[model samples]
Target chain A: MSVLVFSSLLFAASVAAGLLGAMTGLGGGVVIVPVLALLFKVDIRYAIGASLVSVIATSSGAAIAYVREGLSNIRVGMFLEVATTLGAVLGAYLAAKISGHWIAIIFGVVLLYSAISSFRSNVDHLVPIQPGTLASKLELTGRYTTADGTHAYSAERVPFGFGLMFGAGTLSGLLGIGSGAVKVLAMDQVMRLPFKVSTTTSNFMIGVTAAASAGIYLSRGYIDPTIALSVMLGVLCGSLLGTRVLVKARVSMLKQVFALVVVVLGIEMIYSGITGRI
Target chain B: MRRPSDHELELSVAGMLRFGVTAAAVVSIFGGLLYLRQPHASITRFQKFNAGGPGLRTISGIWHGMVHLDPRSMIQFGLVLLIATPVARVVFCVIGFARQKDRLYVLVSSIVLLVLLYSLGHGFQ
Candidate 1:
């Protein structure tokens, strides 16, 4: 294909990925990597670099909105970032040393896990746990305004949450995906933050985690400007547009469809990695 | 003076993030289009993926490229701005916490900032 045509196609694919990703709350990086690496025959490194850019774009975009809405907890977000950022640096360093095939295989597994987890609803609010001494001292407790009214919640299991965030950051750096799912798992399940707080806080942290490695990727020459330019712009546009549809659109069906797509892509990635095709 | 609450701090961070992402997006779009208009190697530059271009590997490199209107370097410059946005947020948080008299959080945010800068400065090598 001609350069223009190829670039256009990639741009369009990224837009679709971003759209689905936004509506599903998965973020766009997961789709961009598999499509670029498996379908377009781009090398995994370039694909990852490009995908990470999109992750940062989508996360920052949505995070701005969440922050404005008062859904995200700033204190919790900042405290957890210390762990995630450190983990991101470590993961990025490991990515530079690991073989491409292994990265692909690991990405496939992560993708499949996210796909299965995507089917579960994030709308359910959990019982707020009592804040630990560390959490109380750090002032991680906060209230978020919902349609029902302002609800107060406290953070628990600070040490466990911090440890999990480290793992989330590592996965994000290694795979170039947002690792939002893992971040949510840490905050929602382990930390016992409310659903809204957990999701929004996860959104807030993703950009920083991705940024930690984005510089590393740039220095490694994995972030091809041409590819990252198209991917980031397309994903940004798509995610913005998707946000408009999110309020009115029925997303359960769409989530099912997108989850299936992720499963297929995951299997393909794993198969290709094993066969040395990617 | 009453220190600003976390709520107010979040609003400031939100505004900063919005502005940063929007600015980065515009610059990226301009650079991407310029890149498309020029005669380039290929849609996918796998070979060049691992080869660092001097124009995008450092801060000075980006400045020099922007001065010369190099599309790739311009795009890299925008990306640097995007990545730096969150780092900037972390910086903002450190100051916010310090001003709020939250000594512990100020220390936490500063540690995060140091880690981020260290990786940006040396991780690739």
Candidate 2:
């Protein structure tokens, strides 16, 4: 295909991914990277580089809205950031040494795991557990209102969550995806935050995580200006539109659909990675 | 009832400008280095500078140094400063609104400004 045609297709695919991602609480990075690598024949490194930029764009775009709406737990995000940012830096450094195939395989496995987890899980509406020690001292717990009503939540297991965030950050840097699935898992399972709070707070935290590695990637020459700029701009616009749709979206159905889609993509990635085609 | 002095406003504006300028400067400086070292084949060169590849290094060096930072770090920083100016304006507005004990306007305006800023920063750019 001509470069213009190829770019346009990528742009449309990114927008679709952003739309699905926003609606279902998944990050666009997961969907974009594999598609670029497998279908478009883009190099995994370049795809990853572009994915990281889009992650930043989506998170920054979504964060502003979530924060202002008082849905995001800013303190939770801030506390967790220490872990994710450090992990991202380490991950970016590690990514330089790792093979593209290994990275692709890992990404595929994680995507599959997240899809299954999404399908099996239930959205808990319980009040979140309070933060202990320094976390509590920092005033990290807060409440947010959903369509149903106002629900208060708290954060716990600060050390564990932070540690997990570091791992998530590493994966994010390595795979060029937002690592939101891992962040949500850390916040929801380890920290025991409610789904809403965990998801929103994860969204709030992704930008910083992405930014840390983005600098590394930029210096490493992975980021293509045209590709990065186009994907970022496209995802940002799509996400803004998606956020509006999110307010009115039937999230349960969206989650199921998203999970199914991710499973397919994950399988495709695995196949391509093993075949040495991606 | 007291108000923030003009000096306070100046200080706040200056602080925002400083931060924006600093971030842009850092990006530009690294961007320049990436541009300068694009032709080299050394992995250490790529590692030290953090260039992803030759193409990225070339582009960032050109884009950031010329379009984004040509005038100076201060100029690039000014763009950030400009982006944040409304935030400072709104904080003062809210403070003034609060002083009048008209809490409603402050709440409404704060949310409005937050949404506006969020959209502008995230959407068009």
Candidate 3:
């Protein structure tokens, strides 16, 4: 296809990906990679680079709200970033060494996992775990305003949470995704943060984590300006629009539908990877 | 002077991020338009893996291209800005942590910053 037609189509696909991502809280990177590689026939590397850019766009666009809501723990976010950024560098380095097929296979598995997890309702438990010694020393405890009142929570299992964050960052760098599911798992389940805190903090950290590898991608020639331009702009616009509609809409059903879409895409990616079609 | 509360610090970071993302988006759109205006824009240049042009591989190259109105470089410059936004946030946090008289978090933030700068400076080349 000509550049105009191709860009237009890619932009539209990215918009849809962003819209679904915003409504489902999955972020746009997951869908964009599969769409670019499977439908547009773009090379996996370029697709990854482009998808990572859009992830940053959507994350930063949503940051203002998350920060204003007073849920995201900046101290917690900053501390864990050490692990994530380090892992991001490692993942970017490994990307060059690994084959595209293996990357696709791994991405498919992660996609399936995230989609399945999204189906489970997050029941926020108030039974606070005791903060670790490191967490206490570092002051990694805080309270957030709930509808009823302010609720306090503390960080637990700091080392384990940091390790999980490193794995999340590695997956993010490897697949060009936000890896929000893994991040939430680390913060909410492992670290014992509140649900709102976990999700918003995960959102808060994604941009920095993704940015760690983006520069590497840029220098290494994975980034295609034309592709990234369309993808980032389209996703940014779509997610920005999606957030406005979100307040009025019920999203539980929407989440399930998007999860199903993710499943299909995950299967498609794995099939193509196994068949060497990508 | 009193330390900045978490709420105030978050507000500042939020404002900074909003501005950065907006500026990046505007620059990217401008670059995209210029790119589409070129005669050669009809041809797609991304089918295979190539190391990209000199104009986009380095920060100085991007600056030189922007001076010459090169579309790809302009778009890449915008992307570089986007990448830097998060790094900037980390910097902001470091300062915030310091202002709180929290030496441990300042150290933590600095380590994260160093890793980020290292990645951006060069891949494991």
DockQ of each: 0.65, 0.08, 0.75
1 or 3: which has the higher lDDT? 3
In model 2, what are the clashing residue pairs, if there are any? A219-B50, A219-B51, A220-B50, A220-B51, A220-B52, A221-B51, A221-B52, A221-B53, A222-B52
Candidate 1 lDDT, tens digit per residue, A77-166? 889998898888888889989888889889889889889877665554544545457777788888777789877778887899999999
Chain A accuracy as TM-score for every candidate: 0.95, 0.90, 0.97
Model 3, residue A242: distance off in Å is 1.5
Best by TM-score: 3
Give Cα distance to truth, residue A61, candidate 2, Å: 1.5
Model 3, span A173-249: residue lDDT tens = 88888999999999888887888889999999999999999988888888888899899989988888888878889
Q: Pick out the ten consecutive residues of candidate 3 chain A with the lowest summed lDDT.
A: A125-134
Candidate 2 interface RMSD after superposing interface residues: 12.9
10 residues in a row with least lDDT, candidate 2 chain A? A60-69
Alpha-carbon deviation at B35 in model 2, angstroms: 18
Give a tens-digit lDDT track for model 2, residues B22-67. 4533553444344433443332221122433332343334345455
Better of 2 and 3 by lDDT: 3
The alpha-carbon RMSD over the true interface for every model, in angstroms, is 2.0, 12.9, 1.5
lDDT of 1: 0.84
